[model samples]
Target: THARAHLPAAGAAAMDVAESPDLQAQLAAAVHALNHASHPSARLAANQWLLGLQRSPHAWALAVSLLASADHPSPSADLLFFAAQMLRRKIQSPDYSLPDNAAQLLDALLVAARRFCLAPPRLLTQICLALAALALRAEGGVDGLFARMPHLPDPALLELLTVLPEEVAQDESGDTGVDSATRCRFARELLMHAPAVLEFLLAQSEKPAAADGVPLHERNHRILRCLLSWVRAGCFSGAPASALAAHPLLTFAFNSLQAFFSFEVAIEVMTELVSQYQELPQAFLSKMPYIREVLLLPALANRSEKIIAGLTSLMCEVGQAAPGLVAEGSNEALSLSDALLRCVAFSSEDWEIAESTLQFWCSLAHCILGIDEQTSKRNATQELFLPVFSSLLDALLFRAQIIDIDEHCTGRVSSIPDGLVQFRLNLEELLVDICLLLGAPAYINKVCLFC
Candidate 1:
């Protein structure tokens, strides 16, 4: 009787399986059996069956709960990966909203993340990525996910950063098979909303002895670059930059820049700084002397034309914000003017560099002229602006000679011809502007000598 009863329910019950309470009970039994079964194949089959039933929320919650339990110490890697995939799908699903138990689930995942750090690096990275995704989604749904994760200690946060670069590299290389759009979305979310996480990363960079075999400087630089990228990406949105600036994390960034002056990092950080705070230049000049020598100068004297253009725009920000300070030998203005003259005089083989250099000179001249007219130190201002203008015109003359030499040797007259035309036009315009501003023929004549 028992065998026959299990074989087929006969009559109406068997025919109406969809509505049968017995059938529902049978399916629940199967799901629970699969979840607890000792056999790996049985667990996989159970998950597949649950997925087929579209038990998204229930399956995800169970997976998260299983991960949270210390007794469930070592779930199969396949099971964990599938769980992560399901969670990701749930996040992407339009119909899915944060579950009532989301905060509990997130809390569980944070615990799991800490545990996963004790696992191998490959597994550790995957778990960290999954937890980051969950946290990011929780952020979007919950008003304050950070506040909710009050128990998430700094150790867990630092562990996440430890594996972040691996995850990023995998995602970037399509190793994780995550799409670019999704990766970018995750990065932007983490960067904008997770200030504490970023701060944690910055703090980790400061403690060389605490780092687990990773070079402190290399780690610090990479972390700094990553945060800078996030800030730049969110510039139009305004939220990320403002959030970062308001956080204590910025102190780490500022201190890191002060410790090391890589041309690349400096340019990136400085550009973001100026974009976020128009007054940042004055602040930097007042506090960070090293920033002037390393980052600001190389940027102004960058041989790359595109870099020079960006540097010029940055200098313009400096000039516009504090004309009086800039003209009065403020570290930034003096260093910038010197760099521009050197770049103009030396990097003349590239026509574009020469052109940018001249344009930068004009901007500097304009700023100086403005300061001279408005300030009490008229003589000192004239003295500063005059030498800079003379140096610029001399650079222009030097460039013309070099171009003529190249033209004479290579018979590339056309290459040099356009530059010469532009040079003359700029020189004439600069002279006229200076004459008008200075109200003196001698200043015009001094500029004319080099032209």
Candidate 2:
């Protein structure tokens, strides 16, 4: 009955009155014709027909329903891609309104996404894009905020600004606004299914590379980007974003350097996670065992300077965000101290790691000495100095003694040629600071003597 109700009559007269199912079938047939039709006119007709269907109410329901399903009627990546595009277009239509069962539909899409665990990147990205669009639509038409969002409480807007970019917050759209009650409905829906959604994206990045020239990891990156945008929308706030920040699978994906593309994407995702870190509570921050794992990835340990540079930058920022949180394990302070020392002594082939490490050391030193020209008052750095300075002095002295051999390796080490003399002076300066923090004689006896 539903099919018959949707079926078009043989004549063009009934095309406008066709039911949803009928239009969907016609659109599918048109997509098939476009792909397989031999004659130019036939392909052109099919293309035009498909576009016409895209603007119809039926197109949104059909595409979203198909995506919401676990069993795809067609196996073609192109078909799924087509469905994804149409879904976005339908949502973008000015006359469109939320479907009767939009929540159920959202749930179905999440289910289908998890079900299509091995779906190709093209299909996955399209699905993600469609989902992203829905996220905006769910946010009460994406532009209603300017008319009302600005006047909300500071905490509300501030939190919202935290996740979304300024451009998104300020974007102007003419679409009719969604009911205030449902403004955050889509983001909340995503929060419930975030695990599956995030899991599927991470799994895509981990898929074994195919001989095909396509950069599969890039697709994973885009989908993850979609996820980040939603997270940044600032709906679920506390737990969901924190959970993603600490997910082990994501960590593994980032550490998978064998797949260089995936590793790069993971690096980027990890770097961006810091922005959300400021909101995480101390108890939640410790759950992040992935940090140490990423820091110690054999591929990035000391081999790939570019890769390690990203991780080091994240580390510095992480420290800035959370006073002592660095890497996983029982003894985080010691682990971070050792990690930074190793990062410096046998650091990258560029000064990025060395300079970052030196800065980190200085940052740590500042915590205790706090004696810059800015203020005369300095507080003791606490017990952390013992292990940290001990490890740091050994690395710095090692760095000072190794001389030109280490100098030539990191291209950014120094500007002057054969400038080992100046390099030692710089090293002495840092050591002097460390000694001031740990007590000059005490630091030399405990650390420098050993080095």
Candidate 3:
């Protein structure tokens, strides 16, 4: 009867095995081969066989066996990750129903998750994502899933985040932690746990440790990555998200942007915040004073070229978003426009950097000159707009076709004259548009300069 109970559904059309005993034996063999196969090729074949059973009702049965194998004293990140993924996918199917042993199944996963913190980043990320699939499942069924026996989501999930694989801290140094979209997707899943996860972050930020010798700033940096993930994914809603906004102790996120040699992470966090401020302009622009403070940090003067370019472009975006913030005398005294002009003036030799810097200048120039505004001209002054127009004129100088190398070249070519012409066209158009905004006199000067 045990064999009969495991048979394919009676209504399973053409593929219903006429015999239940044969199918059950195959299932047993597949599980055994996967567990004891001595050779790598044999193991690969067994893994494939189990994967193939994914279309059958018994796929959940196969998943349980595979997940069990993941616990061997010497574990395989590959096997453990794939098995968890398979189980997660199995539970996701609309036709698949949870078995009587649902609690037991989740308990196994919880045990695996507890130990995955020591795994490599790729494997660790995958497992956390898999558990996330379970905790935040089937939409409206979340409450039911949450009520099941086991630990609170806060501690369980916080442990996963606390050990954050070290790679994420290197974000500003050119390390890509994970695909941004994937990170955001999992982040949303984590946020579905809400106030619990937020509580964990709040607790850490309150009394952080030099645990394992990790610096306090670096720890907050990783925590902010988790926090910002929700922001980027637009999951910054609900009580927990509101609590984060109101947390006085975590004010460092916005304030860290000015720290000397020690705050690259904070600079990056606030930069992202400013860059993504278009989401809630009112909320973000209100912090313009602090944003301006970040823009004027003296440390930027001595930083590397990459830092110079990133911060310069970011500050420029801040100016574009809140032009009034940079319009001289409008803010009463200091304005971000001075810092923006400095960024453009120093980076004039690098076209990419110069272009980004100038683009911001052009935005403000258009604002001041009333090029596209349907209403009356802004109350902008010559002193306010002088740096903008001057910087654009400097950009125009880069477009001058010095020699037209395509004409004299007899051998291999470098950026054919057509390519160079197109390149110059953008700068020429930028200068022309700016001059046009500044009116006829500036336009005539531009044409004469090109000549």
Candidate 4:
């Protein structure tokens, strides 16, 4: 009761002692008192109080001792759960840093978690993920983080995925709930250890399926999507390519794509891959023929501007990395371009979609021309490029005249008036480059007028 009365004061005092030179002795005495306390409630209270102190050697040591003690029978599952939650909170506090005994503390916590057998699965998973987070953060940088947790066990990696959805959905209400922070922190920690995590997923994908009904193809695809999300997040956050590439997981990720050859996943995966890696594998380029036309090309030709834009950006990345991969002989590229032009030429609703479609066409033209030098000996002709360029010029002129009419009107312009302004700008720049490449002004004057 006295301890409860002075709880606030006790917490402040503990925080003060946490930073003092006599911290070790003070923490030792506290642990002894905590262990001997007649009430389990008081012991839990003391543990919480100690964790509340800003991280110091003494506080960290006491928490470790309380969590690590093997002689005691496992605490009630509720108390154990709360203890794990409190420890996780301490680990996640942005101001706290793990002390030298972090690994030892983690080992002890793992032992306790197993022995106690925490329920709902998510709780135990949170504890492991927290430990992994601490281990990664303690290493400082990305490379150093990987160095500390190299070659993660397959079972451990699987455990993370197994618990991921529960952890992610814990706060389905989406309020500022405790589980929300816990879930976010756990994800941030996983990303910190991405290399090992990525590699483990890919390795699991390669293994033959168990006798259970689950198919290997579906399993690999699931794992691939999860890893791809991590890579996308890392790239979005400006993670360095060198740090990302050094990870064995990324190598496996790329290898999986090279091996699987699914056109659907490939379109999404390849765009992000080239954007992040800034290069595509020669193996991927060589196998472009295997890409399915029905799956990708028709979608590129649809009226959905956003989808068309995304596909265009992806194609540009591929062209920049490997120019000839999308040239005439590659039926995939030709079919995709043909479909895109048809979509533009036939669409009746809006000019913006047409403009984007035209821009995509121009970009494709530039890509083909860019590859001509590389394929010069193969006799890939100017004739093959002319029809596409001619179609683009016609689209550009139509868009420009629409813009002029809208500007000259007195009242509100049509909703879709002159959607091709940006497209014209891009087309103009592309024509300049193409003319320079062809070393002739014959088509340059006509194309420059649209710009």
Candidate 5:
């Protein structure tokens, strides 16, 4: 009569009296009080009760029962999310040990997760975190967990893989109650599986969206996020920079930028790709056309400010990633520097997009200054970058000038916006770098002329 069917033997030891018939009634009441209670105090009491249950010896059984109850008509999303969350918390608790019933628990979780494949993503995310935590703490590690993941419905499975790397990396910070030794072991295990993860992601990317009833763009977005997560976890760190540059996932992410729906995530993926793998000459070379295409978007003038800002930010990363290329004045470099200069020339009110390019300019300035006067490339690089920085200096000065509002009110200069003031400070730092490239005395003479 006990709700002990899904409870592992290890977790069952202390559940005899805790699994009474009244347990279900108590749980239902507490859930209702937490969700629909009229009074704040009632909800608080219910929350405290649930927290106590999370730490109870019978918590595993209770959560399993709640998750398995999805077969009943109209199961509560709150219940499913709460159960999944509780499992994750328990697994990450310092006092927790690997339950003898872990495999059984995994099976139960997989089943429960599949039942709610189309559930709210928060619930799916929690379930995935729980599975990830379980995988990290148990015997077989991520390889075994990944081997069993195919049984999940497509969305559920993707969500699981997506969260696995992120959770493992987060646990390495020691916030998950996993000791450093175990964390290091799990990290090693995760690295061994990285290749498999890459292959799996590539395969998933090739699958049509219709196969899983999820939209193609949505599926690809998830794949992009998974790629980003893996990159952040250093899964690809061991790969040669050229191989990473040519990776199919990175190519897919680049292609994703062409779409309206996937544009934001695609920018993020590309930005991370270039920023982290700056040494990828092959990758940057291959991506030149795409980079050029983004800057020349015919409808760019019609796009929203946020989209333009995102594009500008991505270009800034591109500029910093290959400052050498920019100094070499390759057509690609010139095109990129042109785009950045245009961003700097944006209306004074739109200072943020302008502000974003300051670092890129400063970087170009340093790249130019670092050139040896004895080298033949030195003068050529200065000639290439001179106009670019000069145009930027002019733009910064224009941005700094306070509006007089009217010639009649010339002495009463309008108050400079705080954003512009901060932007000017940033401009000063870049000005120093620029002055280093073009003699400081020349810069002072130019300023004196403006005065």
Candidate 6:
């Protein structure tokens, strides 16, 4: 093929396979040897050969051909995955380029991603990643690159959107070879695209079910996951709290929690938003009443351990994010605190869910006892929390009573389980904080009872 003749030689001594078939055969043999070779030296040689192949200009075209090939029988999954991976690397390489062939490369990636959208998600992910890298590296950014990609199926498009923010986040963190200036520019472009992306997600989520029969819950879960990736990437930074609060995506996330399939991701989305309270106080504040009424409070009463654990962590997130709220003794704060108290004191041998509240308790103790100029305010704060601290101390003491376990069950006869030891250490730190607040002698007497 004329394409092989035009392939830029990798180096002075790099071997050149003369045709597509020859190159494909060489890559397959190398992959097999690297995976299945019995001898160390043969495997090492294959690894070296494949690494050398990646550096060749031919690798760019070869990867695309392997990914998009339909003329021959379908390639092995390993070869296809390698091809997708290679395409991503080539796009990411600062020194790698096909100045005039970028459009062709982008089209080829979309084709490959579309072909493999149903299964073996890893290959599809790599193809999407390659497209994302190209978008960052291309001239007009996401809009331009995606503008060229007008006909992708919904699943492929969603997958691409899902990976775009993740790729941008990964790149902005300095893992990619692209220079800081380029990554910064790309990130700004992505943030610029956030509104449109959110709109896209809302539109997709509102469709009762996809034309292709993707379940409503699954679609919403993916949409929420994409929103989370963007939020973590700082795409929503400086957006108005009111605007974010009113966004359909936020509403959709809240709504998703009612459905079992989407509940876990929905909790994560809510937790992330709650965590951003310091940055978007009004946004999270506006939702706090709803969160307490519809989500946290109700979830706390449920008997499912998973629900209890998730909502407990979320409640703690709110408490830690706004220790002052806990100090102020708002009805909302009091209610969430009551929920946390139940978590700590809930009857269970495993302290894992209870342990989630330790940091919040420690933060509250700090708030109650930290140096304050207003003696009256300090007293009021201490007065409000003293009983809560005392109750918590009692729960900790009750929880600390040692219990015998079958030696074989833990696989250690002498040493305490690491989990138990860590739980006790954390409890000790919180106990000291409680001791300062409730009076040392009272704390000592409480421990004496446990002793």
Judging by TM-score against the true structure, name the best candidate. 5
Could you tell me every candidate's TM-score relative to the true structure?
Answer: 0.51, 0.45, 0.62, 0.47, 0.87, 0.83
Once all C-alphas are superposed, what RMSD does model 2 give against the true structure? 12.5
lDDT of 3 at 100: 48
lDDT of each: 0.53, 0.52, 0.52, 0.49, 0.75, 0.75
Q: Residue by residue across 1-451, what tens digits does model 3's lDDT show?
A: 0111233422334123412446545655655667777888877887787777665665555444444553335435455555566676655443455544565556666665655544555554555555444543333333433443235343344444433222223234442323445444444444566555556566766664665344676556656666555444433444353454445433656555554343565555555555654432234444544554655444355544555566666666666665544544344223455555555545332345555665666666555555335533353454456555665565446443444455566686656345445445556555755665567786676667767
Better of 2 and 5 by lDDT: 5
Candidate 4 lDDT, 254-333, residue by residue in tens: 44543333323544666677766653434344333432243235444554444444444444455445545555445555
lDDT of 1 by residue, 333-404 (tens): 677666555556655444555565554455555666665355567667777666666666566666665343
* TM-score for candidate 4, residues paired by index: 0.47
Q: Candidate 6 lDDT (Cα, whole model)?
A: 0.75
Cα miss at 441, model 4 (Å)?
9.4
Clashes of each: 0, 2, 0, 1, 0, 0
lDDT digits (tens) for residues 10-39 of candidate 5: 354445433455886687788889999999
Root-mean-square deviation of each candidate, in angstroms?
Answer: 12.7, 12.5, 9.4, 12.9, 4.7, 5.1
Output the better candidate (1/4) by lDDT.
Answer: 1
Looking at candidate 2, the ten consecutive residues that score lowest on lDDT are 1-10
**Model 1 weakest 10-residue run by lDDT:** 1-10
Off by over 4 Å in 6: 1-19, 29-48, 94-100, 171-176, 277-305, 346-352, 371-377, 407-413
**lDDT of predicted model 5:** 0.75
**lDDT value, residue 300 of candidate 5:** 53
